[model samples]
Target chain A: MKTRDLGSAAALAILGLLAAGLAGCAPGFDHLEIKIDTLPPLAVSVDPTNVELPVGIAVGITATPFDTSGDKMDSDVVLNLVPKNQKVLAVETSLDDRSFVLFGVGPGTTSISVQVDHESRTDIPATVKLQPME
Target chain B: MIRKLLLLLPAAGLLVLTGCPVTDASTGELSNGRFAYLCVDSSDPTCDGIVGKAVIPDLLAVGGAFDLEYAGDSGAGLVQVQPASDVMISSTAGTFAFRIPGIAAMLAKNNGGVVADFVHLRGVDVDHLDVLGESLAESIKTLEMTTGVAAALAVSPRDRLDARLGGALAYTWASSDPSIVAVNMASARNSVILAGIAAGTATVEVSLRSGLKMAVLVTVKQGVPMTTSSSSGAGGSSSSGSGSGSGSGTTTTGAGGAGGGK
Candidate 1:
């Protein structure tokens, strides 16, 4: 009887341990997720496409900014004249508007590019002819 | 039971630990937005480095655009002028002719000398002919021929011209339209030069003749000082456990008892 009791007690203890282990495993899985929204597309278009101005004269240029979502982006748009050596001659900013006018450029043919937050968004090569005062 | 409890303790602790959310170091609220700082060292003769520092601002507002022109010791080359409208000039040996109507012929005549030699008009207004000259024609002609609508002509003093010409022949253009406004070349230069040098404390004047009416000043300084600094943090938690048990007693005693009974 004593031996049977000891065996039963040992079995009970083992059962209890198994029950505890099973209880620990009962909780359902938890999932946490993080996601970022897509950024809006930015587009730029220049009017007149080409410009010619005599040296010492100021040429006014207009740059238009557009976003894919039709929602106006508050980002500032900058117009820069990039020379062959990649040196930036002039940088002008337009705020919350579709167009900007840049004045007083020196003589030279260079690429005009637009940057949004320092990111090159669009580039168009342009020729500038500066005629000496006759 | 106690052993089972002990086995479960680690699992329970783990559940508690896992229940807490992990904090991402990179996900903290930003204290500020970014900024670009440029410091040019013009004071130190040996140090010509331009230090650019990017800093995060305390809060993100709509960013602004900036255009900064630095005028240094490198002088801008020459004076330039731009005409507001088209101008036409006809030059004859001793006389200058302008296409503008109603101007007298006397206003067109100048002692056969280069226009550059007389009347060094830097930034004269085309509308102002009285001070510039009588011949609106001459003004128009100069404007048409020059990149700038304005021309700078230096008129030698009569005494000087008399001495220089030695009375061989001398002529001057007179304008019938005395009401025309003329821009003061000297004043214009002063204004432009001041505008160019406004950025630096050092009074180095740089003048460059960029175009007709375009003058640029490039300024270089010896030294400018600059400084910068940055910091960041992250954290996580986990727990786990397992347990097992078995028991048996007295097989030898039972075998001996069975032998005795047999």
Candidate 2:
């Protein structure tokens, strides 16, 4: 009778552990949140594909990166913008790093290129000129 | 049953350990980025022994150029500049130019993101000028040179104590009288060679693109200068001795000699 009692106890412990193991295997909401960040986006684009401004003035612009399913990525990703002719126009970074400021330095024309994580996103044609006399 | 429980306990611990995968995003060609400046010209003495001295970014001037090296595991990719318009990088590896006067960060990026970065402050005005092979006192406002000899003069940008490339290409040198002294660009853009054309006085002026100017008076002599000495009085001395043993004649002779000397 003692041996039989030990066998029943062992069987109960095994069942309880298996049930716990199955519970742990079920995916949690937190796992889904992690998946959202780890997924890579497909393409990045900048608003206002072309820009024109007067010298000595600055304007802010935004960049949007989307995924394969045409969904916009809201995660904090590294972005860079470079001007082809710095003497004509310059790109400055704001506090949030999500957006940029373009300053007109001289009366000329150049193109600005956007980069996301070592990949070329898009090129923006920018023109800077003197304001017309009032 | 006890043995089975022990085996199950080990398996449970193993499962917990393998549940989460460790992900290090900086693995492979994305780790340990470093930067350095390689000296391409010998005229800039600051480049001497600068191979490993570039642990920190140094000051630069507008229109100045430098050779920079971005060291890292690029993983089959090339490094490029990002985000600043005050500086420019060239297709040739490690060549950079300062375009404007401002504090800028030259970010070096590759396929793995920003692997290295260098921050530098650029200035437009020069603080001091140095005449090679001459003392600071001699080169401050006036410089003396021999006819047919050339003196190399270099300009230092304000607040840049050690940088030798002080926007050398942006400096314009002119002589008040080219007949007295001629100014020409030295091998290093930041320096100029003043050749004494004739024995006369002339002003050598250096101007920056931003409109700041500095001038030095240069007096060219025909040959080496002669240092003259002041005239000194002639030195004279006299001594006289007389025998004490009844030498009346000798005593009289000594007195006469003393009177003559006086």
Tens digits of per-residue lDDT for model 2, B152-249: 77654453353444322356778886655677776665568887645567898877676766788899765432244222100000111122233323
- Model 1: per-residue lDDT, tens digit, B33-53? 111221121111011112222
Local accuracy of candidate 1 as per-residue lDDT tens digits, A1-134: 99999999999999999999996664322211111111111111224344333322222233434455344344343333333322212322222133222321344556655554455655555443333321
Q: State each candidate's clash count.
A: 58, 0
Give model 1's clash tally.
58
Error of 1 at B20 (Å): 75
Model 2, runs deviating above 4 Å? A1-134, B1-31, B39-45, B48-57, B73-77, B81-95, B112-139, B160-168, B224-262
Comparing to the true complex, what docking class would candidate 1 get?
A: incorrect
lDDT of 2: 0.50
User: List-wise, what DockQ does each model earn?
Assistant: 0.01, 0.03
Q: Judging by lDDT against the true structure, name the best candidate.
A: 2
